[model samples]
Target: MSGRDYDHRRQMGGELIIPALAVCFTLYYFTTIWNSPWTAQVSAFSIGGILLLLCAAFFIKTALLLRSSEASLGLGGLVGIEDVRNGRLALVLATIGYVWLIEDLGFTLTTFLFIAISITALGHGKNVGRATATAAVMSLAGWAVFIWAFDTRFPRGWFETTMQGLMANG
Candidate 1:
């Protein structure tokens, strides 16, 4: 294909992707709001509104980038296409795995694994030790924040019996 054709195709693809993502985000936001509990309506509304705003920002950024002269050469010109493709695949896989494991592995363990896998897959392999340590720290911090600060009851898996006994005697 000619350079011009390739450029036009790239631009068109960007244009389509941004709008599609925006539409999906809009639908998701509305669906979440609609399905939210009555008691948590205000909280859900606030979160949904924030998500919608973020999605709008992403849409605007994508549009602006696509309109720029650099987009003619495609996103490959800005960021290596191979890296972007790999990163995107990693993100998709991590998201799917997180959803699948959320019930069986529980939120804490699944989130930890998800973070580690995502970081490793997104070209962060130079410091495996550091990445693992950081993932562990971050995961524990998240667990503490959600369990203590929010008073949320995250599933404790098969260890719940022992944990409950400790809590009861303490």
Candidate 2:
């Protein structure tokens, strides 16, 4: 076969990160909801069960793809260009930080920050102002829809509490 065909073949390495993370998160989700109400448990298990099946399917696909002689296990597939690697890493950090801080910061504020940071990172700082504006609008809309309209069980922080108070009084 040609070198071009060889290069076009399979690759792995950090490709496993996403599936591994999905499995871990699904498992954690299952573990946390054990004491939850039956309805909640049923919903969580249904979704997590799908996630596990998907991960299993992905792993099987990866295994089959790796069976090729041209398969590569290099880390190059993690991020294509070296320049954007930092940006991707920043985005990853932003996601981790978002998950870690969402409970304390409230849904609106945390979503705003996460979206802003993500946009800025992906845009390479070329659109920070626009990112901030978009983040604000999106976050407020999320609050209006999820917290105000639907009144879902999202974690409440300063913004949520203050907004609830304003709406109650006014």
Candidate 3:
């Protein structure tokens, strides 16, 4: 009945959200691949099962922490940290934009721009040159591995289409 006890319970409840989400996702994944071949579903099944167990362990630990009155349950400290909130929001928005633009710009170009901008944004707008160079190298390496080494097809946007056309004509 003490205020301290109430606070501890609330914090434990807040910490439970992540484990709850993991459990939900694991169940969803299991159901989706339930009918697939064992070879195709093995990785998903293994990873999902491991994730579910980890979540269960987390839930138990948090519950025990609350029972022992070692921590408060309020979520404000975690979710209300202003600097982290802004950075996380920006990153999420950038990721959304990257996904939206990928079809039009193609994977290589879109990923390059996304990585550069994400690095700069996450770094609080410092070190633009390094971010750009790193992004370029990563994007090119990914393109080479996927397109050349693996011989997988990615969507072709304007630049890819133009290059293909030029090669055909020549």
Highest lDDT model number: 2
TM-scores of all candidate predictions against the true structure: 0.51, 0.59, 0.57
Model 2, 1-170: lDDT tens digits are 88787777666667878889999999988889889899889878988899899999988877877775656665655567764755887888899999999999999999999999999988888889999999999999999999999999998899999999999999
Q: Estimate, for each residue in 1-170, the C-alpha lDDT of model 1 and write its tens digit.
A: 57775555444344445556766776776776686778757766776667677767866766676576434424443335665666876778789988888777766677778888788777546666766777788877876677545757886543333544666799
User: Where is model 1 more than 4 Å wrong at Cα?
Assistant: 1-10, 17-86, 148-150, 155-165
Deviation (Å) of 143 in candidate 2: 0.6
- Where is the poorest 10-residue window by lDDT in model 3? 76-85
> Which pairs clash inside model 1?
none
Per-model C-alpha lDDT, please?
Answer: 0.66, 0.87, 0.79
Clash pairs (backbone) in predicted model 3: 8-72, 10-73, 11-73, 11-74, 12-73
RMSD of each: 8.9, 7.5, 6.3
Candidate 2 lDDT (Cα, whole model)?
Answer: 0.87
TM-score of 2: 0.59
